[model samples]
Target: MSALLRKIMNFGPAFFAIGYTIGTGSVTSMIVAGSTYGMQLLWVLFLSCLFSGALIYAYGNFAIVTGQTALYSFKKHLRFGKPIALMIIVGVTFGQWNSLIGILGISSNIIFEMISLYVPSAAEHKYEIVLAIAVVIIGTMYSILLIGKYSLFEKILVMFVSCMGISFVLSLLVVHPMPAEVAAGFIPKIPEIAGGKMMVAAFVGTTMAAATFLSRPLFIQGKGWTMKNRAQQRKDAIVAAVLVFVISGSVMAVAHGALYHEGKRITHVLDMVNALEPIAGKAALTVFFFGTLAAGLSSVFPCMLIAPLLIEDYRSGQLDTNSKQFRIITGFAALLALAIPIFGFNPVKGQILTQVFNVFVLPLVIVGILFIINNRKLMKDYAAGKTLNIILGFALLFAIAISVNGVIALAGQF
Candidate 1:
C-alpha cells in the first residue's frame, strides 16, 4: 500500500474507538460538565484523554505481545482460574447490556423529537412508531456488522463523527465562550455547582469508558498487531485520543457558551439541542439532534460487535475475531438495541446508570492490565517502564476512588 493509503487504513481502528466513546453517556457527561462546571473541568478532559491514550498504547501493545485480548490476558497472567474468569465475563456481559440500553434510549429521543416536528398533532401518539423506527435502524446496523465488514462501518462512523464535529464547531462559533473561562476549564478546579457531587461522578464515569475501551485487547488480537506494530499502535492511539479530546472539548465549549451563560441547565441530550434553538436557530437544533443520533448509533455498532466477541473468546479459550459464534453474539446484541426504545426510558438517566456501571468495571480490569503488563515473562523486553508504571498505578488508585464514591452516591439516590 502507498504511504497515504496506510495512513488512511490506520485511521479505521481509531475512528471505531472514538465512535465507541462518543455514546449516550458521553453526550450527557460533556454537556453536564460544561453546564455545571463551565470551563473549570476542561483540565479533566485533557487529562482523561492523555490517560486513555496511554492505556490504549499499553493494552494494545500487550495484546500484540501476548497474542490475546485484555480479558484473555487477565485469565492467563492472573491464574484466577475459571471461577474468576467467569465472574469477569458476567460483569462484561452486564456492561454490554447497559450500553445497549443507553444507546437505544438516546436514539429513541432523537427520533421522538424528529416525529414531533413533522406531525405535531400526532406527537401525543408517536411512541409506538418511534419504537418501530428505532428497531429498523438498529436492525439495519446489525445486518451490516454481521456481514463482518468493519470497513464500511468505520467509513460511516468517520462521516458521522465529522458531521458531529461540524455541528459543535458551528455552535462554538455562535456561542463564543470567553477565552478566560475556556482557559480556566483547562486548569482543573471543581466549581460550586448545584449537582457538584453528580458532576464529579459523571466526569469520572464518562472517562471510564475511555480507559476501559482501549483496554479491550480484542482490537490488538484482531488486527494481529505485535511488538513490531508498536509504532502503528501508538499512532492509532494518538489519533483516537486526539479525536476524543477535540470532539468532547467542542461539545463542552458549545454547552458552556450557549447554555451555561444563560443559567439554563440541561439534563438530557434533547434539552441541549432545544436550548440551542433560540441562540443558533432551528437549524442548529437539527444539527445537534443529528450529532446525538450519530454518536449513539455509531457507538452501538461497536458494542454489538464486542459483546459477542467477549463471549466467544471465553467459550473457545481463544480470541477468534471471525468466528460464527462471535457474529451471532453481535446479532443478539443488536436485538437489544430495539428493546430500549420500546421501553422509552429517559436517556439522561440511562446514560448516568450506564456510565456508573462502566466506572464500576474499571478497577478490576485496570488491576489485571497493570499486573499483566508488568509481568516480565509475558512482555519480554516490552514490560512497563518506570514512567508508565507510575501512571498506571495512579490510574488504578483513581479508578478505585471514583468507584467507591460512585457507589455511595448511587446508593444514596436509592
Candidate 2:
C-alpha cells in the first residue's frame, strides 16, 4: 500500500469512534442545546469533546500498553475488577440499547418523512412505514457486519462519517450564522436559565460518554495496534475529537441560526428539518436530512456491535465479526429496539436517559482505567505518568459533577 493508503488505514479505530460519537443522539442533543439556548452552550460541547479526547487517549493508551481491551484489563487487574467489569457491561449495554432504539426510530422517521414530502399519503400510515424502513435499515446493517471484515467495515463507517461531516458544514454555511455570536458562544458561562443545567449535563453525557471510552480498547485491539504505535493512536484520537467538534458544532450552528428565536419547537428530527425549511431554504433542509440520516446510520452500526464485541472482550476470545453468533446477537438487539417505534416512548427523555446512564457509570470505568494504567507491574515502564493522572483526575471530577447534577435534575422532574 502507498503511504497515504497506509496512513488512512491506521486511522480506522478513530473513524469508528467518530462514527459512534457523532450519531443521532449527538445531533439531537446539539439541536436541543442550540435551539433552546442559541449557542450559549457551545462551550459545553467544546469542553466535553476536549475532555473526551483526553479520556480517549487515556483509554487507548491503556489498551496499547497492556495489549488488553478495557473490560478484560479491568477484570484481570483490580481487586474488585470482575464485578466492576460486569457492572460496566450492564450499564453500557442498557444505556446503548435504549439509545439504539431511539436512533432507529429517528432514522426511520427522517427517511419516511422525506418520502412523505413527495408522497403525502405515506404519512397517513406512519407506523407501518416506519417498521418497513426499520427492517431495511437493520437488515442492511447486519449484512454489512456479516460480510465485511474489520477493515472493510471501518472503511464503510469512515465514508458515512465524512459524508455527514461535509453535509452539516455545508448546511451551516448556508445559514450564514453571525461570526460574533458564534465567537461569543465559545466564552464559557453557566446556563442559569431553565433547562440550561440539564442541557449542559446532556451535552457532557452525550459528548464525553462512557461508552466512547469503553469501546475504544476494542477498536484499538481490532486495529492490531500496540505500544509501538502509540503516536499513531494519539493521532487517531485527535482526529476523532476534531471530527466530533466539526460535525456536532455544525449541527449546533445550523440549529442556532435557523431555529433559535424563531418561536418554533424542535421536538424531533423531522420538526427540526421542517423548521429549517423557511430559514435555510429547501436545499439546505435536504442536505441536513441526509446528514442526519448518515449520522444515525453510522452510529447504529457501532451501537449494535458494542454488546457482542464486549462479550468477546470479557471472555478473552475472538469471535469472528461475521459469525452467525455475532450477527444473531447484533440482530437480536435491533429486534428489541423495534418496540420503541411501535410502542411509543418520548425520544427526548430517552436521549437524556442514555447520556445520563453513560455519565453515571463513567466513574467505574475511569477508576478501573486509572488503577490498571498506574500499575507498574501490569503496565511495566508504561505506567501512567503524573501528568496523565492529573488529566484523568479532572475527567473523573467532571463526570461526578455531571452525574450528580443529572440525578438531581431527574429527581426534580419526578
TM values, all candidates = 0.90, 0.94
* Candidate 2 runs further than 4 Å off: 1-7, 317-325, 346-349
By summed lDDT, the worst window of 10 consecutive residues in model 1 runs over 207-216
Task: Please tell me which predicted candidate would have the highest lDDT against the true structure.
Answer: 2
Tell me the whole-model lDDT of each prediction, alpha carbons only: 0.71, 0.81
lDDT of 1 at 178: 90
* lDDT for model 1: 0.71
Model 2 over residues 276-380: C-alpha lDDT tens digits? Answer: 877877777888989988998988888888888877777783535866778788878879767667775656557755666667787887788888888898789
Q: How accurate locally is residue 320 in candidate 1, as Cα lDDT from 0 to 100?
A: 52
State how far residue 138 of model 1 sits from its true place (Å).
1.1
